[model samples]
Target: MSDSSTLPPARLRPEAELARDALSAPVLARAARLARWADAGTRVDAGGGLVEEQLPAAAEQLGLSGDDAAAHASEAWRIAVDTGLVEITDEETGTVAAGEDLALLTGGSPQDVLGVWLTALEAVLADASVPDLDDLVDAMAEGGEVDLSSLDWDPEAESDFLDGVLGNLYLLTVGEEGPGEAPVPLPALAASVIVPSDMGEPSNEVLEQVSDAMMRLDDQFRLLEPVGLVEYQPVDEALMADADEEPAAPVDEADVTRYGMVRLTPLGLYGLRARLLDAGFEAPAVGDLSDKGADALLDGTAPFPPAAAHAETELWLAGRSPLDAARELLAAARGTDPGAPLRRLRCQQALSLVGAEAEPALREVLDDAELGGLARVWLTEHGARDVPPPPQEMVFWLTIDTVAAQLAAEGNSEELRALVEGLARQHSGFFDTVWRVEHPATPEVLEAMGRLHPDKKVAKEARKAAFKARSQQGG
Candidate 1:
């Protein structure tokens, strides 16, 4: 994903809760156990990996009994050494000792423990990018060093592809229309990166690539699950028994999940969001604006989806008095910049949540040149009596401003088209009078109305009025 794109905010768990999860992750937990077990007698090769003689003992120490136990122990030891949970005391003697970060796991704050987990996560991710040992062995050159070209593995490309997949998964989880908290099917997730979005039908070659990608991801997710990044249901082993057959497309909901299903755990969400922010993405989370001023709240949430924006605004208003919050929103809402209309729209939405106590604040701004139309609308909506009707000029100005705000907020949407048509039908001479409004966006709004109105005569009138508006503004 481009770093400049703003992602919908992730709803993260508290650091304390996430830290508990990080500590309990199988990989990090085993790494910690192996770290504490290391002492002066623990031998290591020049690369700091535990020597072959030590693997069996290390596996037994962890109460592991399996053909893969030695491999698992070695992996954990690598994590411990990489994350500073174990340190080699002397390269010549091959002696070892518990490292400083081991203490942090038990004695440090929640953030500190999570910091260690992030380091281990990075190590595992790097491991996941390397070709499997069997592949390397089969591709070995005469001198025993692996030939990367023969193996058909591009280290950087593999890493980038995995990163892109995780990024897509993150977007799926946090997106407004996505399957929030539900496990995404494996074939669909694999297709997201491999398949072109606009493609009508996949050829045999593309379908084969997707099948290969699914198999690769099944292995990757299995490796990743121990680090607590995802909760995964592995692709059923029965499907793998016949290598010649293409995996069947899931016909029903019951059959789909057997292919594989995966979702990010809450801890995974926090980890991925941190990585995104580090890479310069504007990844916002709910409550980010709670303590900010009213101006920040309005402008920062200007591009958010409607539901997320409402949730953020409610958080911002939670601590302030209704009158004070309403007054602050009104002050921030007064500007002539291009973004001003949307800010005012957001201000109106915020005021609606402020209720009857903000009546005085709304009444206070009824005489404001920029805010008067908005204040009057708020008062009338809340059932206040004796609210003076807006002057004719004010009504025209408000119409232009409201249309400008909607244009900014929703673009040339069907709803905006309907509103444009409705306004032309309701007013006998709206185009003639609206052209004279002194609002900065008047010409632009009129031009939009000209395009949106379906009636030929009314559309022609809107274009002429737009021309008049531009001439009056001398632009």
Candidate 2:
């Protein structure tokens, strides 16, 4: 039979494509791990079906409880048996019958099982809507058994079959069982774009190739057209794919000597701006004139004239210049007067433009007593939403006051409610203090707090508070 077209498309990298096929590395890794674990001489005599005593031992070996192990093992056996990986003798026997071929064909170590699990994870990552690990765990805890027999698997396929199996498992685990909001799956196509190590200044060609690859993968996956390129360093180096051994020839400055300076394309600038936005950055202000102020600064080398500094600053903040020029302007503005409202604003704008390079300077200013408030606000706005606010006194007060004002000014109560709910869910520990002070204790507020609270006792406390507040208001 012809190769399955349903598998993800082949790699488009002209050079890399020839070096190796798009094998699921995670799957292979997981399977190999599991194989090693099973090889450690752990045997499950399913002749009398899966026994409770056998489960706890296996679970302990796997660093899990007996119930969890039994559940996972039973599910695995059921799936394997249905997929023809194992055989069953008696129809009445609920336990799996390990035929001679079972050990040789399917048996492996704990590491091997992990490899299998990861292989499945890789496949699930390809899809945008699959549930995450926590979701899967909860589903399993609810006694949901995965139906591996129903999945389409062909042993004869040329590509990695185990990878697909692991992918399905990963998907099943991450999927939501009830009609509730689920975790957003990071786009696979977006995930494929690799960032450089330095992240300072990649050659134009490298940037172009990455952008092109992103667009191509986006088309293949049918993902939403990204507003702009979002570049972030992997949290851990281990998360990154190993770089190719054969490196491309370094670009010489002499090669571009005849061309003078490289200018940023509008799209490139847009990508830069988007990247900043993704990092939680805001546009700097170049005075009152907006884009014009930025253009004037880009044209000349001198410090922005005081008369036009505000407009100029705003322009700088708006990210209107070539990347290098933008960087220079930002650095100069920061050096000139670090405390200038316009400077701070410009600094915020510049940090976003500079990407990770600005982290040190931003962090430094973030600790200054006078500058920290503005610096942190700007940083927090531009950085990851999950980043914790600075523990300083003024910053805390400013943030709380700002949030309160925002909640008060919100035009749509429904939207405000949702926003508040999300905030409370994410920072439930602060709910009693923040929510009560800023927002009136409505029935919706009580429900939202209760839903997001991890401890049942805390949720009960919140409900009681809401009830007391409501009763006092005679609602």
169-286 per-residue lDDT for model 1 (tens digits): 9999988889989999998899899999999887778888888888889989999999999999999988888877757546588788999999999999999998899889999998
- Clashes in model 1: which pairs? none
Cα-lDDT of candidate 1: 0.92
In candidate 1 the C-alpha lDDT for residue 113 amounts to 97
Worst 10 residues of 1 by lDDT: 243-252
**TM-score per model over all chains:** 0.95, 0.20
The candidate that achieves the highest lDDT relative to the unseen native structure: 1
* Model 1 alpha-carbon miss at residue 59, Å: 1.6
Worst 10 residues of 2 by lDDT: 223-232
lDDT score for residue 238 of model 2: 32
lDDT measured at residue 262 in model 2 versus the true structure, 0 to 100? 19
